[model samples]
Every structure is written in C-alpha cells, then in structure tokens.
Target: MLDAGADYLLAAKANQPGLMGEIERFFADAPANLTSTVTEVDKGHGRVEERRVTVSTQIDWLSGDRRFPGEYRFPSIATIVKVQAQVYEKSRQSSQVRFYISSRSMTALQFAEAIRGHWAIENSLHWVLDVTFNEDAARSRTGHGPANMAVVRHFAINMVRSHNDKRSIKLRRNKAGRNPQYMAEIIRA
Candidate 1:
C-alpha cells in the first residue's frame, strides 16, 4: 500500500491474534482523552443494533516489538479503531467487538462513516448481482464466459438503475422482462 501511495484501513481479525490482543490491551488501558468515540443505532424488523466506534492515534506503545506470537510490522499504522456492536431482538441481546488499523489519522466518526460507506457499496453490488441476477449460481467459468456474463449483468443493472422511475430494482427488472415498451424506455433512458 505504501508502494502505491495509498492508505489502507484493515480489519484486525483472528489471523492477527497477536495484534488483536495488543489492540485490546491498548484500549483497556487507554487514557480517557486519548480516543474519540461515536455511536450509531439502527432498529427495524424487531431488531435493534447499536454500534460504537472508538479511534485513537496513541500508538507509541503498540510497536511490533510489543506484539506476541511473532514479530510483524505494519507500515504506516496511524490509528487503531475499536467497534462494539450490541444487538437486541425481542428479549434476547448479544454483542460483539471488532478491531481495525488504518494508515490515515481519522476521528472515530470518520472511520465509522468510511467503514459503513465501504460496506454499503459492497453489499449493494453483491446483493444485486447475487439475488437479482443469480450471478453466483451461474456455471459460466470457462475462458471469458464468466467475465462476459458479469459485464452483461452489470450493463443490465446500470440500464435498469438509470431509469427515472422510483420503483425498486427488482420491480423494474420484472417489468422490463414482461413489457417491451418499458424495456425500450429503460434502454433509451
């Protein structure tokens, strides 16, 4: 990433157990003013989820030498982020915690926004391609078949999405499948 002059915000998962442990310890002993925090709540369909994000740049004590298991150094580690998600459904409640490292110095809200925006795009595209187009169930893996089919699906999605109608994508797709005039209108638009 440094070679490309680009910044990265990477999730710290089980693969980096040592790093994750260090991050947990760092946050546990963090000074009250050393980090910034932001919280968001979403409720729908009998489910409520609250996410709290905390970000800090106080990493002088979090060098590669401080980690256990192995000596691993991440270049340009500028911020450490912790996300705690609490979920409530009916009378049951659960919670999870996740960690991340970023090359950019960002506030907790900024990191949360960036992470949410990234997932929004990723989820939108994958859901459209998978549920709307059934792209994953396709057996066109030979040569350029997969690539060609993906391009065609993307073109169709773009065409349908570019229409002026306020209808959902699935509805628009269904209408286009049954009505030639509507399909023409979408293509023209």
Candidate 2:
C-alpha cells in the first residue's frame, strides 16, 4: 500500500459498502459539470459491459483524513471516473471505470488521461505478478518465510527493472546468477 502519495483513485466495490455508499451520496449531491467521462471495455470472465457516466459536476467528497488526495496539497482539484467490467464463472460480464482527481484544474479529457495512467500501473505491476510471478499462489503461511521471500522477490524485481541495459530482466538475472562478470556488470551498471 506504500505509494508515492498522489491522489487516490479508489475502486468502489461491495467489499467496502460503507465507503461506496458515502461516495455515492457525495456524488449525488455535488455540483453539476464538476467531472464528466465516457467509457467502454470487455473484462473479467467472458462478458462485456459498456457504460458512460458524466458526473454532472464535482462535489466535495473529501472528509476527515480519508479525503481524495491525502493532504499532500496539490494545486488544481477535480475527480473523474469511468467504469468497465466483466464477470464470468456462474455468468459473464465486463466493466471498466476511469477516474481522475487533481489539485490543479483539469478538463474532462485530461482527467480521463490521468485516470487511465493511474490505473494502468495496477495492470502492469500487480496483475503481472499475479499471472507471471504466481504471487497470489504463494502459500508459505508457515511463518516469516512468506514475508521474507516476498521481500527478496520484490528486491530482485526492482533491481532488474531498474537496470538500464537493453537485456530483458529474466536474462539479466540468469546472467547474474551464472556468471560473476555479468553479475558485476549488472550490479555496477
């Protein structure tokens, strides 16, 4: 959950019913034309659902400490969200949501881009780990092993990703493991 402390673009789900309810109520009462958006997507199990939502406007949803931006103090202010998703298993459906918030004023289109960029990191990092690294499959619930292994993996992944060479991280790590010279080059580079 450690992040660079940018504006939070949270996904509304049933898991947090109270929070979702609060957001809904806030949006219902916010000013018109504050935020706006359109979205389309096919995701999840095997269904596609397209939805467009134009927040008549932006409203004051920030309350206490859980406000939109964590009080870092940005200049402009706006939040936009577009959702697309799909659900399979017993049934099939997909949906996607685009959201944006800023301390500096921004147009709807700019908001769309910002929101998209914000969420794509999840697709690139967390999703990749779940699929390629089998992160969620780790079942070492015995003790510190799980936590320790997770730390090592995160460190290794960060090291390889931080490399400037054109070589793929997988190859870079393999080289580092097999050849001392290559390892030195990687570590020193």
Candidate 3:
C-alpha cells in the first residue's frame, strides 16, 4: 500500500509460509529482541477473556535479508506483534496465539486497541445483520439479488436505529412492517 500512500498493519498467516515461519521464529526468540507487553481482561456473555499483546521493533535483519523465498521480502515491515488470547467458561480455559507484521510504529497497547476497534465495527455490523435482520437465512443468491437485498437491509437497519424509541431494532423493524404510520414515522426520522 505504500504506492497508494497508505500505511498498513496486517496479520500474518500460513498463506505466506516462509514469512509466517520467520515471524514465528522471531517470537520464539522474543527474549533477545526489544519487546513490550500489555494485557487486558474482559468479562461478558458468560465468559471471561484475557488478551496479552507483545510487540518488538528489533527486526533490523529484514532490511536486506532474503530469508523468505520468492517475492516474499516485505521491506517496510517495522514491528512484529503477537497476541495471546485466553478464555474461561464454566471453569474451563483455553488459549490461542496470533501474529502480525506492521509498518507503523505503535505501542503494544495502541496496537491492541487498533485491532479491537477494527473487530468492534465488524462484530457490530454482523450482529445487527444476523440478529436484527436474519440476514444469514436469506437465500437470494440469484444474480444481483443478494447484493441488492444487502443494501436494502442496511438502509432499513439505519432507518430503524436512527429513531428515538428505546425499543430494540428487531422490534422497531417488526413495527415498521406491520404499522403504516410507524413506518412513515421511521422514514421521516
């Protein structure tokens, strides 16, 4: 994205096997690198989650290193980040780990916040579409019907959410479909 004058902080996965292996090795040797750590705990939805984020900017070897095969050299990479997520439910616990490479120099806490902010928008939109609109059950995949219906669903959701009523979005949507006056009020709002 440097050609587009945009900075990126992207997660690394096995799709790029060499790069992912190198990053994993780097994290395995995090003690030698200049690394920082941050942690956050959240409790909700009958579960408790603990997230630990670690970041390092000591990857000077990548400046001209040809460790990765083919065109896998990412010169703009400035930091390596590792996130460990632990979850507890009904007295049982599990954990997972993920890694990322970033062009922007940010603290572990800032990186964690940025990641969480991105997921918040994604989760909120998915929740609204699935729970409030039953979008997952839609079978309008013929031609442009699915895309068209998605746009209409988004518009309806926005209209319902913009009203001043304290009722849920699903309730408001039901009222709008049943009552013409309420639908008119929602449209005007």
Candidate 4:
C-alpha cells in the first residue's frame, strides 16, 4: 500500500513468527525513552475495559541487511505498536496483548483508535453474518468452498441490505427464500 501512497496498520500474528518475536523482544527490552504510550478506559456492555497502547519508531535495525540471508524485511514500516487490554466483567477479569506494524507515524492515541475502529467494523460484520446467515455453522470446508460461500453470503447480505424493507436481515432472508418475487426484488435492488 505504501507504493500506492496509502498507509496501513496490520497485525503481527503467529504466521510471521520472526516478526512477532522481534516485536515482542523489542518491547520487552527497549528503553522507556524509545517508546510512546497512551491509556484509555471504557465502560459498557456490563464490562469495564482498559487499553494501554505503546508505540516505537526506532525500526531501522528491523529492516537492516544484517539478518539471515533470506529473511524478509517489512518495507516502509514507520512504527510498531503494542496494545494491552484488561477487561473486568461481572465476576471475572482477563487481559491480552496484541502487536501491530504501521506504515504511518502516529501518536499512541491514534493507533488505539485505529485498532478499535477496525475491530468494531469487523465484529459488526461477523455478528451480522453469524446471526442472519448462520455463517458460523456453515459446513463448507472443502477446497475453495468456504471462500466461495463467504463471497455469496456477503453478496446476499449486501442485496438484502439494499432492499427497502423494515424487517430484520434474518426476516428479509427468510422472505426471500419463500417468495420468488421478493427474491427478485432483492436481486434487482
């Protein structure tokens, strides 16, 4: 995306073991002066949550040529972020830490907001898909079948959302299943 003049923040998950390890070690060993941090608290949905976001811009060594011969380098990485969240529910509490790499230089607050916003949209879409289409229970696990079905589900969701109806998505989907005219209208929409 940097080649296209766009910046991105992406999770550094286990799939990138080397990258993840490097980030973890950096946060664990780096001096306080090398990082910027921000904290936020939110209360809702019967839970109180606190998020601490830390960011570092000293990544020149990460992309240096001194690594193993074929190791990949993250190009244009301007910042690395660590987000640690603590949540307190009615009778239980939990904590988790996540890491991300960003192409843009941003304040810790901006990173926190960007991460939360991304998850909010992701959770909303997944919740709707699971509730309205029973996507979680789908059995399409063969090669390419799961991906193909996901595309179909997303198309159906968009079509239903476009149709002028006061009913919920589940109800609209049921109506479309039972009524050919309604299905046609949804398709047209």
* C-alpha RMSD of each candidate structure in angstroms: 4.7, 6.3, 3.9, 1.6
TM-score, every prediction? 0.67, 0.57, 0.72, 0.93
lDDT of each: 0.90, 0.55, 0.88, 0.93
lDDT of 2 by residue, 1-189 (tens): 214545544455555555456556655665654645555443554544444544423435443345453233323334434343333444544444333233434554555555557657767877755654578888888879988988877776777677787876667777778998877766665
User: Which clashing pairs does model 4 show?
Assistant: none
- Residue-by-residue lDDT tens digits, candidate 4, 100-144: 999899999999999999999999999999999999999988999
Measured with C-alpha atoms, the lDDT of residue 123 in candidate 2 is 74
- For candidate 2, the TM-score is 0.57
The digit string of per-residue lDDT tens for model 1 on 140-163 reads 979999999989999999999999
Candidate 1 vs candidate 2, lDDT winner = 1
Error of 4 at 143 (Å): 1.3
* Most lDDT-accurate candidate: 4
Model 2's lDDT to the true fold? Answer: 0.55
Candidate 1 vs candidate 3: the TM-score winner is 3
Q: Kindly state the number of residue pairs that clash in model 1.
A: 0
Residue 1 in model 1: shift from native, Å? 3.7
Better of 1 and 2 by TM-score: 1
Ranking by lDDT: 4, 1, 3, 2
